[model samples]
Target: MSSWNSLWKWGSVALLAYVIVRGFSTPLQPGLVESSPSRLAPGKHALTLQAVGQPFAEPDAESADFSLILRSGKELVRTDITAITPHSVEADVIIPEAVPSPAMDAFLFTPEAGTLFLGNAFFVEDAAVGPLPADLRAEAPTEVAPDLGFSFPYQPTIVESIRNLLWHVPMWFAMFFVMGIGFVASLAQLRTGLVKWDLRAEAAVRTGLVFGILGLATGSLWARFTWGAWWVSDPQLNGALVTVLLYSGYRVLRAALGEDERVGRIAAVYNVFAFVMLVILLMVLPRYTESLHPGKDGNPGFNSYDLDNSLRAVFYPAVIGWGALCYWMYTLRLRMNRVEHHLLTR
Candidate 1:
């Protein structure tokens, strides 16, 4: 027990250090601004340019010369942007001088900051010119573009660094992992009819539910920023809620059956059933149903796409650290359960 405690202590410190270093090193997604003349009165039209992203908070002095290219049909018409604010700029288009009706493509760049192509499509049309042209017919690849130059949003404080990912998805993984242990322990109790295994199973489930609730709360907060909703009735979201409720019901069953020897076996059976349902409901159903959740329905999963390589370096460490911390909590609960069992018998 002493050795395990020592190992956990050292492991936690190392994991935390790793999460902090990587968080600072990681580059967040760059913000984008798209502006164009969707409709025009057949005269000079202006397309505005804007800088976005967390970095925009401290605008780069070198960004004063930001340029945007406006492509009319197959030709590049406008090549320079008039900087208004560090975050915004304007591009003037001489109507007929550029193109009769421009099927536009907007591109922006700074001296040190590399290029960014706005994904939002825009066009200009005139009564004289028919449908302009679909010169660029290919889909814009929706992936993180290489940032030739950028900086972190905030100074990488140790807590903020590790907490970014820890404060997001690690809780879910920790909850899932602990609950999975309970599922297996419950199965063992069912097979051997052992009270010891039942106690372990109960402890694991109880600890897991705590993390599960935290995961949901954290996820809801992150969702508000990224998905624009506190809670959306999406597939993955609904699936997670159902899984949490199912486990809550497991505890309810155990409580209602106070002092019954059969309670353990019955709850064990139900744990196995609930776990199976959890997999099906949270994992399978979300993929089949349309979801606004970042990870499902063609949206980027937490790390696969949305999180860049930089984020991954910190995120994976946060998972390990949080997992270690959760295990610590589980061990404490398991010991408490054993103590309670002995007292009840005595």
Candidate 2:
């Protein structure tokens, strides 16, 4: 038992170490990060687009083979590449008097890199005409084979911050995993009237709270970079905050009922209720309403495209490793509670 426990503990540490090193070090695939003058006017316009991650155009690659396309509904309007750099490109796009759609999505077909996409990149407004005539529209781009390499998908808004998915998301998952254990333990305490179950429940809540707080902090940092705010009014974000606050009340309830013989039973009941609210607020409510947060109503999550096989390789280990570490903390706290109880009775 001792040998197996040691193996599990160290295995978690090693897996977390691997996740940290690989998660941070991996490069993102090439994609457009920003474009100057997001709104384009009718007629010929000079545009510059900045790129993040790997180089889109190869050093030896010719400009003739590369193409920039703007999708206005079904019509593909081609752009003339004026100049190309490793990290940025300048182009001359001739916007028709009118387009099929006002919002244009950009796609860069590169020889070295795959087709990079930026949805709603440039908005066409106040054009001289309505939709472009079919005869005036450009040809669709030729298909180019993607450069198959191990890298995270480059998201337009998320970009390098996509790496946070490995840390922020898994922390919440691990917290929920441990907190579920506490909820079950609390139920057992209420049924059996056992102090041991109460201790286990308390330890689990304390350990789970640590990860919960970390999840919020990491999520806040991620939001600051991507959403330009430390916090948002989004339902999912608020739900997470409320869930943490509710669990925190569990500890306060235990402290308030000190030395009472029924303290364990009362706190156990509170914890059971708290876990139910956790599911209702964090899981159920977020799905029903519209949210800026991904995986919610109308918004396709990172899992749809961003969480590829390369990310999963590091991500799965992170969840397991963090979960193991959380359980280890619970066990330590449970032993401490047992020791304290023995001392008080003596």
Top TM-score: which candidate number? 2
- Model 1: per-residue lDDT, tens digit, 1-346? 8897789867976997877665556554344454644554445667665546434333356644455665555555443344446456566655442353445666665443455566433565554554333442223223334454334332111212323454557888888899899999999998899999999889889988998899888878766756667898888888889988999999999999999979889999999999999889877888888876556774435524334444555667788987887888888899999999999989
* Count of backbone clashes, every candidate in sequence: 0, 0
Worst 10 residues of 2 by lDDT: 298-307
Question: After aligning candidate 2 to the native by TM-score, how far in Å is the CA of 75 from where it should be?
Answer: 2.8
Candidate 1's C-alpha runs over 4 A off are 13-29, 34-41, 54-65, 72-75, 97-103, 121-166, 298-307
Q: What is residue 67's positional error in candidate 1, in angstroms?
A: 2.5
lDDT of 2 by residue, 1-346 (tens): 8999899999999999999999888888888878878998887899888898976645344347777888888778878887788898888988777788888888887877768888888999897546676655677667787775878877767889888887888888888998999999999999999999988899989988999999999999989988999999999899999889998999889899989999899999999999999998888898889888877784535545544788889888988988888888888999998999889879
Compared with the true structure, all predictions reach lDDT values of 0.68, 0.85
